[model samples]
Target: MSAAFAHGLIVGKFYPPHAGHHHLIDTAAARCARVSVVVTASTAESIPLALRAAWLREAHPQAEVTIAPVVDDVEIDYADPEIWSAHVTVFRHALALAHGGAPEIDAVFSSEEYGPELAHRFGAAHVGVDPDRGRFPVSGTMVRRDPASCWRWLSPAVRGHLARRVAVVGAESSGTTTLARDLAAHYAARGGPWAATRWVPEYGRTYCEEKLALARRRAKATGLPKPWLDDLEWESPEFATIAERQLLWEDAAARTGSPLLVCDTDALSTSLWHERYLGVASAVHPRARHDLWIHTSVEDVPFEQDGWRDGEAVRHRMDARFREELALRGLPHLVVSGPPHARLERAVEAVDALITQGWAFAAPL
Candidate 1:
């Protein structure tokens, strides 16, 4: 069968692209030989224009995607003739850039009422996809108002916009890793308010392991004394680097927009480690305020001997340091102690209380 239109145009704010927007684009792509998706972002939009445009390009590779920036100072009133004319001019320029010329647009695709006027401006047919919205049963407004409730509708890129972070911290062998993983799994299974959850493992441990291995190899090659794990230095600069890298990893995980991000040993833990090992305070602290902080207790869990782990005495000292630092900083946190299962339950309870207390999901600034 022949395509109904030679070229079609789909335009929207796409503040955060959702499934319904995908349906409209996909429908247009199927019926048109060529499709151009214009993502117009105003300065007032919380999400960046480039990010939204990138989502459209990834979502519908078959369509040509472009971003149009609306100046922050301009008052947007589509009904006004002056405003409509200005937008039309911008759309024309964007479309021309996409096609490399003044390509003919035969159809205008949308799920909005303005499709007719837009189509008329281009002298094209208006093809409204799911105007009644019964098929997708979702809208940008609905998704924005309550992202957790509308998690199913959002794309991963947009999910990052609404995700709340939870950090799990404590001394070595304090069940921080296990509790973090369990908290993520618990949220994933529950599947509401936050449709999904992600966990970030301790990056410092991995970094130390890699560096120690390299140091040991160099010692053997040069016939120098074998480097002992105890000789590993924890300087203020190293702690600052670890904290920065940990935050980067957490932010990368957040891009998927999982309702919750469970991080094992965030930058705050690094600060405690720096103070304990080198007796120097961290120059850079974890600046991002997590929605919830779960401090695992070093008491019940037996300290496991690892290549890099300090002894039981060190664990006890570090645990005390964590408590002191947390208190001194006045950061609210829940201390979870006991066996793994019991600790998991307490952490879950704390998160539930937060949700019940109407914890707002404030995306990282």
Candidate 2:
């Protein structure tokens, strides 16, 4: 460990501690004697600053992560004139107040807009993190703007707090269709709420159709060249869109209080497809950091051609790609492999484990 500094502050809107955010904090903690995480209550309902503080507390019990109060009284409308003055002013005051107090920090870690400004203003060193060579996805604004379903990028500790949950993940053609349906049935049979993977019904094809439709619609609405717009739409069949969509689902799941919900695949699993399709470097979705990850590998079963069929080589590469990515990220996941029945059995077991874990969490209440 490096020489421990007197104190360090990591300020953020955490929204929730996504894996990337946690990684950054964990990195910061090692370099400092104490880490005080000051979370901004950015909006009226921006995932409770207190809950973020609690999450940091739970995730890094070892680090001295303190939650600073909302000194900046502001809302989400950046366009408003009152926000510009009130926003930066309140935040600067908060930093001054924090730095002025006893046990002052020597440094602050951040990946925010005013990181450098804070460091200079407070007379402290600033730290920056770049997961993909300066391609820092440090925009809490982007995350906040993402539909509620996008909380899938959040850490598992946060996701576990949700009531309705669903995960639909499996290897190529391991009967994910039947399996998702069966899981919903089983949950209902047990007198529980139902969840299903109805997003794409069968991934890719529906998305392709929708993209085509959107392209045409936009062309008509804007009176732009139909071919050009259609081409733009064609290139936009990205993994991020689907990943973002699933995130919206997570929002719904968390809010419904449903016992169980079925999902297709999450960002972690979806990263494989993204990597293959978009050529983007794959990182585990924040949710996978602690959320249970299920790896499907029931090969030797018949593959389906639901309009998104590629050669086995492509599927195999994508599958292994995700598994390798998961391992590299050091996420908590289970690789369910075997025959169809065996695979489904493993899935049930994995889900049961999550359910038990959920129930165990509720036990404290």
Best by TM-score: 1
Model 2 TM-score?
A: 0.47
Q: Residue pairs in steric clash, candidate 2?
A: 149-247, 149-248, 150-247, 150-248, 168-263, 168-264, 171-296, 195-262
Per-model TM-score, in order, reads 0.77, 0.47
Question: What TM-score does candidate 1 reach?
Answer: 0.77
- lDDT tens digits by residue: candidate 2, 245-353: 6666566544442345565566666666556555775454544312555667646665665554555677677677767877897866677666757766777787777
Stretches off by above 4 angstroms in model 1 are 1-7, 29-36, 42-45, 57-63, 71-105, 191-196, 233-258, 275-289, 299-304, 324-332, 338-342, 356-365
Residue-wise C-alpha lDDT for candidate 1, range 1-365, written one tens digit per residue: 88888888888877678999999988888898878887776665667778778777777766343433332323567689887787877787777776677778899998999999999988999998999999888887777666667777877666665677788999888888889988898888876655557899999988898878888899899998888888666567877888889988887888774777889987778877787777777778767747778889997898898767888998898888888877887776888898898999899888877666543422311
Evaluated at residue 177, the lDDT of candidate 1 is: 87
CA lDDT for candidate 1: 0.79
